[model samples]
Target: MRTQQFSRTARSLVAAACALTCLAAEAAAIKIQSRDPAGFGFNDPTPAAPVGGNTGTTLGEQRMNVYRYVADIWEKNLDSDVEIVVSAGWEPLACTATSATLGSAAAWNVWRDFENGKPGTWYPQALANKLAGENLSNGQPDDGTGYGNVDIKTQFNINLGQPNCLAGSGFYLGLDGNAGDAVNFAATLLHELGHGLGFSVVSVQTSTGYRLNASATAYSPTGLPSIWEGFMYDNTARKSWLEMTATERRQSAINPLQLAWTGPNAVAGAAITLAPLPVVKATSPAGAVPTTPYTASSFGPAVPRSGKLGVLATITAQAGELGPGCSPFDAANAAAVRGKVPIINRGGCTFAEKVKNAQNAGAVGVVLANNVAGSFAPGGADPTVTIPSVGVLQEDGERLKAAVAAAKAYGSRTQPGAVTASFAIDPNRKAGADLAGRPLLYTPNPLIGGSSVSHWDVSAVPNLLMEPNISDDLTLSVSPPKDLTLPLLKDLGW
Candidate 1:
């Protein structure tokens, strides 16, 4: 992450001007340059059947096509004279039976103080090139180790969905949005490219909240801010990142829902892109509990706005860690949980498994309590799990537990409707946006490296392309009326 600062140096400006003059007059194009070696990665010779509007006949060709398609989408939405080059490849990134790094990308380099750029703000290489009206990169071939002529460097998981590598979930090369159980390759590309184009900040250490210095060699308390930080508003601190100290910025990064994107375009985009967040509200407990936010499970039917009203109960495990509710509840536990919404601890099993067991135990609805702090929309699909389910943060779950215990101690479960609650969408609050219609950034406590403070909050309805997680519901659209990515880019002066 080098931040090359431009000056009034005639030599540099003339070089840039010469590069721009050499290009043919045409709309800016995003070029996908393969960085893979022969017989592997993007060069793999494996045969592949065309599917979902993708006509490539080989594995590598299909992967390349997805990249090109994503690039074309960005090119169509953006205006620039200099062509943006993305160096992309495939590699065996981290993978497991449950999770995998489908892909990752970042700006190859950053620039500041360039022509038509904000002073003291670092712009990503591609965006910098657009603003400067010239190609500023070294224009060297990439070997997957360092930055060069490329504006963005990206790589995907080659062994994905193979044995021992997220075994059952691989990349779907289809141009159509029907990814089914596999990850959508084009959607992932769109997301990574957004980061490269300008969606991410160049924080040397997010925990310290330090941006790269002018030279970009290291982090500093007085370092230049990334253009992305200009829109990072901390509602709790009542200040934007541009107005905060490093210490204050660090605190705001972990403030969860407190950090929001204050860009006007994003704010307007959120109004149409996001829906009201679904939450669990305890009406009987009233003043005893706060309205709790939840992430709806992708597997079940959408949580109804009408709400599911029931007594909240906890399931007991015959044997397990913290009663995760991995296995079916026994007869006694079933009776206790029957006709109620059971709050099951996360982990020990898939969300679908837990919900299916709760449904079998006669649960009308379910709440999957986070085993850890923070919240995420629970993934996986199970057609048989008919009851709706939502996820609550660990602390929120604790609050619910305490409320239930208090109510239970005071009154009988059947008599006064103890622990009575309803899980439903709250029309007052947008899912991933603040009350002011600004979209919340992913600012989890304890800081999720590469995720926190960079991507959109996962609670976003319809799932924006810039969210940390690649959702199954994302479309190719990156502009307004359907998506917020292009709007946000426009905010960054795209």
Candidate 2:
């Protein structure tokens, strides 16, 4: 989807030095053990050891802060009540400490393995054993038992050595080189923890030894079988549930899900949802001579002159063509409502420009159809453009074009200079109405009230990278242990 990039105001604050030891009690909530005895590592500590004869700022405390923040966000989002333990001693089992003598290239290689592919041949087994030991000791499932005993590990190889990583991760946030930017360490940690809590790619073994995978799915612990099973079957059906969870979490942070514009920290009011443009149908015979003129009301649903629905309008355009609203008004079709909806050829200019031109022409809505054979881009609408819009298949546009040509040959001359077209709106389309500048309201829920949890402030660490737009980027994997009843499957068919 095309998203509008907007500049946001920057906020700054001087970070007060506080002893890391002071947070030890809080860290215990996440099962994180602190190496700093006096918490001096954060507030005041001995000078760091020199690297290449240069000393770098100690990041131990900042790293711990990130852990705390992640735990807090997770606690807030999860439906179940569970305690999260963030510990410094829990070394990333997937990564190995590199020797000081290794060059940057070698260090990067070590990091790259963690991000793209599975762990080394020895690592998974060893890690599984370690986790099994921990679980068994805690009276949980041991290795080769239930799915819960399985340890699935994936790496996020963020390049901390690069400035982009720092900026993207929101670690080195402010102009003064201080922390506390809106996209701060805490936010990054929250995102990463999202991955840890079943928000990454997942697969399940099937009875036929095949695997089913869906690019996107919802998160559900109940759907997933125990980890002890080997080899996923029918993986094609797997969906990324993690992505949905992340989106919900991010939305919750920025705005309330129930109330569109009522987010505690929303930058704008509730957004408007516009409908798709009406299509024009042909009324004449094929290959007939042009004899009629197009009129403004020839298309589907007349533009509402008043009332709530009147606040929005839609105009369809040919695939890879300019939208009806964006196309320049054609004098040859003077009576035609060309400017009302500019239907230019598609697949050239960006959707942003198309929507911009339509908005410029006093159009409140626009639609772009595909010119070629392909699915519309997911989330195709530009995020920056608040106006409601959608895309149609190229075949559908061609059919409409044929209908218009037939109408012209039928001598249905309403006007020589007028343009008229109409098409039906799909009844099953997702329902959303446009209401700009409106307030969204929701009732209070007594079952779950407001509460706060640990908040960690993360910092850049050497050779690690954090995912961007954590809200929508993460994905989850889930599968049923056995074939579900046909009735159940049909009832939940998506």
Candidate 3:
């Protein structure tokens, strides 16, 4: 829930293009058409036309150019034939949503059938209407496969409670990165368009996710009812799409920070990465600094040791926490661990599993002292978790564990302990650990709207463009740092 401030400087850079053209020779090129929502007052900014996503303050041609830029990035890289209709307009910002939001999007008449020989797929109906670019004159070809025929619709935000449409906020809407307190419009466009391409889940989830909404005349490769619920993956439940129960699927969307995208295109796109150097630190309750252990959480925002941090108490007993190496860590222990970092032993399960349990139980951050040896990078693959987590050295872990045991014998969730400490980000560390040379998406325990089960997770070397909220320092290019949105488009059956 931390809001990005206005400070970073923008670096002028061209969107590094990618090899995203559709595979089939007959596949029509991706057509991106922009429109002003009918009857809605929409004003173009200043600076008119430009070369990339950012267009300064100028509206009209400039803003449209940025929209075209986003379309160009996707159109050129995606291997599909379909039209995306975009609607730009102004709307009141809800007190609950991000004020900087540029807009929102949704796929129209959507349906899915395995395209790359995979199961539980979701594709636009317009794309599924034809094969490659083959003629659809004979009643708009019905041979199920590839992209569809109808156009996908989207709405962009021209006003976030602002009167003068061109008045700049702490956001840069040009081809450049954040320029003296500005958000990149190009990058924002990319994120919103990605959602329209089916990077979103149902806000009100049902047993089968939201209905496919495709007409009876629409394509349904599986004859089964189509829904966004059919494409989700729950690691904690180890269930993919239809395999999950209604509850599991709904929970997946709620805790997006910990979920994974199984769509071939999403997985493939997620294969992308950027160089990372996040500065995060976790000192023990005793004030002693631990070893070089670090983490790349896909959930909570990264903070520097030089900045403000979460709880620093030594973890004694937990509440509702469970796992092989876990003990009485649950709600009953909230009084002792509330708002404090809980130190827990590792092993018997994944690093993510332990943190998820601890975080959901009300722990702000978790210091997972390794049950085994040398420091290794920590990981996050679920949505329920939203706290900072780290893997301290074995010795360091034991020190915290010992301190807890001495203060309050036998990990009892109800007993308070004398373990009082603090934590901070490792300013010297700079960035986070490079995640296995690939980007991972975050699926939290309880999902965050719009951000649930989408975007690159913490493992990415440097923060990527599609990581929930776009980073100000992000570039205008379609390169990894500036362009993960297209890669995901490529993954979602392009």
Candidate 4:
């Protein structure tokens, strides 16, 4: 990613001249030129204007407008003067009979038409070289570097099954909010544009961490290193892309708190109110309060609840209740479980089964103790559970368990501390820059490929419009105070 440093006075002048929303006139309005008009397959050549837009426009025309809307947003804010090459037409992007991919975008002509001297192949990191101005001989016309020479491919799925915007029917084609009537193409297209603009890495992810697909043995000139690597930081390992192990880097892709984007442009003009994560505070009778971080259970209701959790000394194992806590379970001590949070180990069966057993024994909530080191969302299915649940670090679990034992041995008064804890959503405040002044690229757990490291965490507060999954209840936006993506583009020398 590149950085475009501006003077404080210059910024102040722009802020003064334009509303916080945007500049009165774009510094440079990047054009969106269409490709292969015949491929779009529209008869009229002109599509309708979208909902609330020019009413009499054609569907094909309406589709182009949405693409342009996304392009306009990028053109208005990005520091680039180059035109974005866009192709918006219908194609059956079906992976199956009923499902299809919505769209995709990427840096173009940044790769060699051939791989490793092959006549027609390209490595993934080739784009990084172009972004870095390495100008590697990729068998394509040199477009210089430090900026994109083409538009991000904002393709759509015009599959046969859905009355969706991409299909030119079910979605509201305008740049306005939908009343649950249609899909919001503007939001979806913006996300794709974000990727094309460098909100992605070409590193290959594995079951563990990520590895560079291409070897980098040089620095400059030959374009040995990928510039995108400089931005990825793993807080868990307290290391950047260069310092992490393959497994460490892979985990960073999903380790919400660990993964971050440390680029000058990303955090530029930074003002964040990060949504805090829930803190499990254990108040002792001694008036001491100790808090620990936790991961919410994947299954069960999202209701955040706080109260005392009763611990059962019995630990369960995986394999659908193979160990203790099985039916006819002696672990279901009514005295220990009735109406209280059931704190138990995460093992012996599915999380759903474990919670089901707890609920059957009168558990008001469930607190799972992690057997692994770092915390992750507890995975299991329990659709009928109405109570909230959470997972704590093993260390924290041990302490909480011991406290329960102490409470059992002696009365509440003699236990020395309050045994209650609170489990609820902790909307974080924005993650400020680390010591190096690099901002974070937060993507929450249950990590997905293609989506990881490419977008903000889904749970991020103040609404991260770039999360992998586009919410139906979204409106298009691209500035800070509500979004951080535009600044990232500027940092990449957009």
lDDT of 2: 0.27
lDDT of 2 by residue, 380-467 (tens): 2243554434344455555545444444444446632222433334222211111222122111111111110001001000001221
Q: Could you tell which candidate, 1 or 4, scores higher by lDDT?
A: 1
Q: Quote the lDDT for 299 in model 4.
A: 70
Q: For candidate 3, lDDT tens digit of each residue in 210-233?
A: 433223332222322333444455
Worst 10 residues of 1 by lDDT: 12-21
lDDT of 1 by residue, 305-349 (tens): 655558898766676543477788889879878899888888877
Query: Against the unseen true structure, what C-alpha lDDT does each candidate score?
Result: 0.79, 0.27, 0.48, 0.53
- Candidate 1 clashing pairs? 139-149
**Steric clashes per prediction:** 1, 83, 95, 47
List model 4 lDDT by residue over 1-494, tens digit each: 11111111111101111223442235434456554356363323554534755243776677676776677776666543333444345565644432347667665433322212211112232232323233343233424542333434445666533643233334456777662534566787788777766677633443445443332321122222233555677777778865666666667776655566766545543444234555566644434445655656657776354554433333334344463344433443644566677677766667777777777777777777766443445655557877777777777788777665554433445433326666544344333333343455644455666766676654344446676666654556666666777665544434
Write the candidate numbers in order of decreasing lDDT: 1, 4, 3, 2
| Better by TM-score, candidate 4 or 2 | 4
- TM-score of model 1 vs. true structure: 0.89
Model 4: residues with Cα > 4 Å off, grouped in runs: 1-25, 30-59, 94-101, 111-149, 160-174, 179-183, 203-223, 242-256, 268-271, 276-278, 284-419, 423-439, 442-447, 472-475
TM-score: the better of candidates 2 and 3: 3
Residue 361 displacement in candidate 1 (angstroms): 2.5
Best by lDDT: 1
